[model samples]
Target: MEIFAIQGYVDLVVFVVLLAVKLFAFINSLLWSAESYEAAGKLTKPAWTIILGIGVLLQFIGILFILSIAFTIAAFVYLADVRPALAGLRRR
Candidate 1:
């Protein structure tokens, strides 16, 4: 298959996966906030830790999404620029 076509497909997949990540993050944030934890049991340290852990996980997940975006962009840039440069070198 052509390089452009393959890269386009990969970009589309990344976009869809990112969309799902956003939705899940929103839901999890709502579920892990103070109010949600308050509804779980007496407002204790452990309860707060659970809430804080959720926040940390959310941040980690956000980082993963950012990295995924970076990699996806890099993939396209490599295909558009680096690959062609390598191809030119190969033809010499």
Candidate 2:
């Protein structure tokens, strides 16, 4: 029983963290201009916004674990790749 309780807490933490990441990605996506995305040679702003938005919605719905993982990867991709590319353009 104690182990189960610990597992539940761990699961809750993971859920919250994933939600935060998705939200961050979605909000960050909204902050950048559409032209910036094109300049960065990435997907359009609307495309990323929609993708991150769906990830956030799915996090809330909490129905499909596989889909959640997939979107999490998407969020990370945006954060790790797209974000840096966009930021680099700002530096130029």
Candidate maximizing TM-score = 2
lDDT of each: 0.47, 0.95
TM-score of 1: 0.35
**Lowest summed-lDDT stretch of 10 residues in model 1?**
36-45
Candidate 2 per-residue lDDT over residues 1-92, each given as its tens digit: 89999999999999999999999999999999999999999999999999999999999999888988899999999999999999999899
In the range 1-92, model 1's lDDT, one tens digit per residue, is 69999999997786666445444433433444454334433343344344434434544455566555554443344335433443454365
**Which lDDT value does model 2 have at 39?**
95
TM-score of each: 0.35, 0.97
Q: How accurate locally is residue 49 in candidate 1, as Cα lDDT from 0 to 100?
A: 46
Give one clash count per candidate, in the order shown.
0, 0
